[model samples]
Target: MKLIIAVVQDRDSNRLSQALVWEHIPVTKLASTGGFLRAGNTTFLIGVDDDRVEKVLEIIRKNSQVRKGWMTPHMGGGNEGDGSYPVEVQVGGATVFVLSVERFEHF
Candidate 1:
């Protein structure tokens, strides 16, 4: 069996969850926060057979998308303690990890 852990931005959570449900893929959603941006995120836990890993990944890939964002750094620039400008950043994507599970149980 495989345990899939997907961490996705909050903006895409609802849509992703809906799509997974539409495919009859069971998922457990947990509220999460991103460390870098301190932004809202969602963690989805899915357990599936080894052969279904690719199918689950395909669903997640179709739902989660990457987009641009802006964030200001805490450090000052140019010998001044105040030139903290917001920089365009890549955000809104899923970080997924697939792990082998020797045993899994549900109640």
Candidate 2:
């Protein structure tokens, strides 16, 4: 068995989840936050047979999109009137990890 952990941006979460459901793939969704951007994210826990891992990954790739966004970074050790500028950064992509599961049981 394989465990697929997909951390996707909130903007793409709903669409991705729906697509997975449409494909008859069972997924557990969790609300999460990103450390760097402090933005909202959704984590998907998908357990599937080893043979189906590639299909699951393909679904994730098709659903999750990469986009650009602006972020204002905080300046450290600055004066009272220090100003922060918005920087363009790439976002809206899934970080996925596939792990081998020793055992899986459902009640």
Candidate 3:
């Protein structure tokens, strides 16, 4: 068995979750926040057989798309040299981790 952990932007969470459900892949969703951008995110936990891992991954890739966004970083300690401007950043993608499960049981 494999455990798939996917963290995706909030904007794409709903669509991704819907697609997973449509494909009959059970998923658990949790509210999360990104450390870098302090932006809203959603974490999905999916348990599936090894053979089905690729299908789940493909669904995530199709639903979560990478896009550009702007963010104004906090400059600690008021300094004259610190530029407080919105910088373009790449966002809206899923960070996934596949782990081998020693045992899985459902009641």
Instruction: Compose the digit string of candidate 3's lDDT tens values, residues 2-89.
Output: 9999999898999999999998999999999989884899999999999999999999998887877887776454665577877898
In order, what lDDT does every prediction score?
A: 0.88, 0.90, 0.91
lDDT of 2 by residue, 18-105 (tens): 9999989999999999998848999999999999999999999988867777887764545646677778987678899999999999
* TM-score-sorted candidate list, best first: 3, 2, 1
Clashing residue pairs in candidate 1 (N, C-alpha, C atoms within 3 angstroms) = none
- The digit string of per-residue lDDT tens for model 1 on 2-107 reads 9999999888899999988888889999999988874899999999999999999988887786777888766544555676778988766899999999998878
Candidate 3 collision pairs? none
lDDT of model 2 at position 51: 92
Clashes of 1: 0
TM-scores, all models, native as reference: 0.75, 0.76, 0.77
Summed over model 2, clashes come to 0
Identify the candidate with maximal lDDT: 3
Candidate 3: segments with Cα more than 4 A from true spot: 68-90
